[model samples]
Target chain A: MKFGFLMREIGQGLSRNVSMIVSIILVTFLSLTFVGTAGLLQAQIGQMKTYWYDKAQVAIYLCTDTSPADACPQGEASSDVKATVEAALKDAALTPFVERYYFEDHQAAYDKFQEQFADNAVAKYVKKEQLNETYWVKVKDPNKSAVIVESFTGVAGVEEVRDQRSYLDQIFSILNAASIAAVGIAAIMLASAVLLISTTIRLSAFSRRREIGIMRLVGASNFYIQLPFILEGVVAATIGSVLASGAVVAIVVFFVQGYLAQRLPLTSFVGVDDALLLMPLIIGSGVVLAAIASGFAIRRYLKI
Target chain B: MISFSNVTKQHKGAPKPALDAVSLEIERGDFVFLVGASGSGKSTLLRLMLREEIASRGDLFVLGQNLVTIPSRKVPALRRKMGVVFQDFRLLPNKTVFQNVAFSLEVIGKSSAYIADAVPEVLRLVGLEEKADRLPNELSGGEQQRVALARAIVNKPDLLLADEPTGNLDPATSAGIVSLLEKINQNGTTIVMATHDVGIVDRLKRRVIELRGGVIVRDDKKSGYETALPITDQVPISSDTEPEQGNEPEQANEPEQGNEPESRISSTDQAEEQE
Candidate 1:
């Protein structure tokens, strides 16, 4: 049989069964949307991880003259103590873990505090002599910041050790939860798409039963009888995929880019370019899904 | 050629066999009529020949293929050598006459070039060349039947089985359909028609096998056929001058000697004598 003839029959079958075709398209579109959205969310989470992890540093502040008794055993950390803390960070044993380290003396600390709190009353009270000196350490692996923080927590001159990853971990936990939920929804919707496409093909076959019977009498092969229905399913899925990709791109650009980008540029959400990058994946999934669903339906219902 | 040796068919959940130990043979180029009342297994016998229903017991062969042992996958290939017509004329509603006829060729993977030549030739054979573009709905009952006939014979099947081909047509139209079938048979295609149209059967004067109560009680082949009016006409011929009178008296005298029941004897005896 000519492939063109098979395709024409598939086109006719789809057109005649318009309601079934639409149902298949809608189910496929919804399923692929959830799938594509999950992918975009994962990409966004990855972007955020890279952005926050790269800048995440451990901030160790030395006790200052204004530090509470809990913070410091005597008065402010002396120049000798601060110098000792800076030298300890440069030790050869920790060299591989630490990328680089910077020290802020009392004057520099005071100036940084004034810059951060220009409108606060605390800025007037904080003089150069009363400020705390600190060493900020950038590590090669932000994920292992806890090891470095523990190393410095009880060191001679360190007043406090903090790893920024702990704070970001809470946000990533929420993103991970959301990603799991998205995957679950996508799986359910994909199953629905398969079922709907199968039912649609079944109904199409039912309506064409007479034609099929006649074809069988004329020595038509089973494959020839089923080709049109399989093609119908694939076409519906392909259209659904195209529509879903368009919707995903529109959502990413108009919503993520236009609104979220302006409001929280620092969050580093996925843009249209990133969602569009997954177009091939989305379309591939759609075609495979349609073909599989139709193949199974044809096998079960059309026995030649 | 078709042959049945003690073929038996028992449908699912049925108390009795649809066909019971039926043994018959139809030669090539012979136009045979299978006559029976409803539930007498006329349709069942036809279905068996098409392999739509397999014999429950015994051997059945068509075109030298053992239908009883043939696999379902190869049934279509076997059917290509046969043309079957149904009472309902199962044409695809969406297809035009040309497409419907062309479909037979299409299914067999005939090239477009052959389809173009063959479809029109078959349409012309059925005398429906002008109605090629018309859908089944647009054609009259007789025209639709002709389209179906065209489709059946388009591939030039070796045998034609028509089950009630003119069941829904008028008497005049029924005769015309039978003549068409006869014409095809004359051209070397064997025809087996199952009909309740006694008028056409009697008029054709071909081989007639009368079935009653799921058995072939009679088989006949002759010319100068006796035409029976339709049941609705209510014009019963007197039994004294009936063509079957001679056989009826002899069968009546020895009713207990034959396996056939007395109620089925007269028709079967006349049919047997014709054969």
Candidate 2:
């Protein structure tokens, strides 16, 4: 193949169908953006899962002075009951499941509540005596919090044994659903991109049938006749892919790292590095899919 | 050289065969005229020779290869040794005369250094050397055909097939194109031209093979457009037993097979543009 000749042909073909080529680029851009978004969403979900789960704890809340008489006949968790509960946590049956443990007295719990709900009207009426003293146990594996729950539930002076993951699981499920939705939309868009690329190629082929006819007569091989048209599609799609990668980077920089990270400081969000990692895949797929589509569209005209 | 032995070409759904039980021989360097009316198998015979259409039955050979069994992959190699000219000049309207002739060589992966040299040489032969920068529309019908001829012969094909090359030219211009073909023929390239131009045909007095209703009725070494009989005569002559030319024996080679319908693809590369 003559490099100069092939380049000239490709340039002419692109110029002849400028509007169609632009549409191809825009469609590929939109579809690949969706794909990149889906990819990043999944990555973000993975990051949040590890961050939240690592800090998950099983909180054992003891009865306060306001506890009902049926559960706490002494009206509050006594010194003896606290000693018994602490001994039980140290027992061999519970020791194997515990990674580490800490205690929060009524004063500490009252201070945390006030810090969390500082702007709420109810926080002004809450007293340190009414708050429960708690044992916050970090387990060896977050999923094994059930072992601690079974050991402490209904024990004297225990008001409730709660797993933090139960609440976090709901948020994760919703996030998982959101990521799945992104992937579904991405699939539909990518399909449209494929179809649009093929149609653009068909129109391009029809417009250049004369040149193609001459090329065939001159004994140009099938690959030679088809190379320029295929390159035209690949070129347009690559531009779109690059634009999409730029969009994804902006989203990470402006929306994720800058915005979501600032608003939600506790959980880690997907960063610019993750978005950068997806660039090659996005661009590579765009190139490959365009080649396949245009290659298929030009087959009828290459009867030789 | 081309040989067709009892070749029968029948298109699907057509009521009759385009060429039926035809047997003929065209020796190397021979210029043969195929004269027939529209739909009288002249085009079909040219298409068969080009391997654009496969014979439904019998044997066909060109340039020492059995076309009946030539693989489709090898068809390009066979076509490289032959050139075709059509009634329409089929010159690229946007291309100047120089680029038009160079296009044929370029398509076949010729180096620019070679195209730069051969294009001008072929242009000189067709008498279009002075119009190298002029587009197709800027030239007269005869000059455009000269460019077409130059393009067809740039690679020095062993055989040239002209399908009504003079069909679109005036008589004076047609004579010029025919003479150029005669010159190319004299250079040892075989020429087979299909036409209905009786004047040029009668004037040239080359070997004429006339067809009627998909069968050959006449083959004469020195003949004119019409016989002493009626010009509309229709007859199917029996396959001739002419002694095969003993120039070269058929070589033993593997036989391959392919079938592709003839292409009537139209091109607008010659659309006229205002200067």
Candidate 3:
């Protein structure tokens, strides 16, 4: 048969089973919505990981004049000790891992502490004489910061060394778990959608058994008879995916950007622009899901 | 041309065979009528010829294809060489008369140029050129049957197997259908009609094969009416030269006396017997 004839038949078949088509569309839309949501969450989590980890720094505190430990028993680090610590940081062995280092004296630390706690009662206790000088070091790899921290710990005149990634690591563990759960739910819903589509197509075929029989007797090839039904399923699924992507975009814009961006500005969650960036991925996934579901469904039920 | 040797068909779950150890041959260009009461396997015989049902034990050949062993995938190619008509007229309700007729040619991948020319020609042959645009529901019973006939013969199949094509029509309409079938046969398309319409059989005076309980009880080339009795008398007369009423039941029952009817036989029967 001609391609035009096949298309016309597919069009007529879809129109004739309009109610079934609509049902398929609704099922596919809801399923793909979950799938898209899971995808966007994963992307957002990755983005947050990149943003927080890249700027993370290791803070090394130097003993001040009131310190109790022998490392700084004189209650202040001598100029020679400070020079030794700075020279050790700049050694050729550590140069590749260390990006840059900046030193803060007691007066600068006291001012920064007071500025951070300006509204709190702690601001009174954070006096100029009690604050310790510190060195803030940036590293090339946040994941490898433990090695550098261990090297700096217990060094002469070094009171403490801590990487800021521990807090971010906890948050990322939760996000990773949630992403896995979302993917699991999406997979289950996807299977259900495929089964529902296959059943719908089977029912459509059963309803038209007489027509199929006639076509068979008339020497129609197996492909010729099956193409229209398969195309019908695919068309319904494509429409559903498009609807789902639109829903995702709308939800991201109205809820995530407009509401959450204003309400929780500090968390650095998904922005409307980021969601828009996922448009190609969302649409591509939808098409692939629909095509696979429709292809397998036709193969199972419409075999000649 | 068709031939069957010791053909027997036993349907699944049935106690008896549908066709029991029967042998028959139909020559090319001959119009034959298969007549039997319901449950006597007339339809089964027609189906066997069409390869719709395979024989349980036999060698059957239609148009030189060994039907018992032909693969299912090749059935369509074999069916394309023959036309079939059904009692229900099996016309697609949504298709126009023109499309219905054109569908036959479409299956064989005929070019649009050929279809455009061939479809109208076939419709005109069936005298339905004016009703080309109308759907099957818009046509009457007889007209629908004619459309089916147009579809069946459009490809000029080698044989036509019609199973009760006129069973639902009125007597006059039925006669018209029989005449159309005859006209097609005269133009050299072999026809095998399965019907219980005795009036048509007696009136048309064609070769008739009568079946009873899955056996060919009577095969006759010449049968004349015993006008002294009612027209319902069902008897087999083998000789065209013999008078209609003089043959006794005892003589008709003689077994294995194949030499008695040599003079009345045709050259076709002689050739068949030689084979």
Q: When only chain A is evaluated, what TM-score does every model earn? A: 0.88, 0.86, 0.84
Which candidate number would show the highest DockQ if scored against the true structure? 2
Question: What digit string (tens of lDDT, one per residue) describes model 2 on residues B141-176?
Answer: 999999999988999999999998977776667777
TM-score of chain B of each: 0.81, 0.84, 0.81
Using TM-score as the measure, name the better of candidate 1 and candidate 3. 1
Q: Highest TM-score, which number?
A: 2
Distance from true location, Cα of B182 in model 1, Å? 2.2
User: Which pairs, if any, clash in model 3?
Assistant: A65-A75
Error of 2 at A247 (Å): 1.4
* CAPRI verdict (incorrect, acceptable, medium, high) for model 1: acceptable
| Local error of candidate 3 at residue A38 (angstroms) | 2.1
Per-residue alpha-carbon lDDT of model 1 for B47-85, expressed as tens digits?
A: 899887889999999999999999878888888899988
Backbone clashes in candidate 2 total: 1
A1-304 per-residue lDDT for model 2 (tens digits): 9999999998998899899899889988988898899889889878877988888899988888797767666667778878887898898988888988998999999999999999999999999989889999999988789999988888888888899999988988888888788778878888888888788888888888877777777677778888898899999999999999899999999999889899988768999899999999899988998998888877754677
TM-score of each: 0.79, 0.84, 0.74
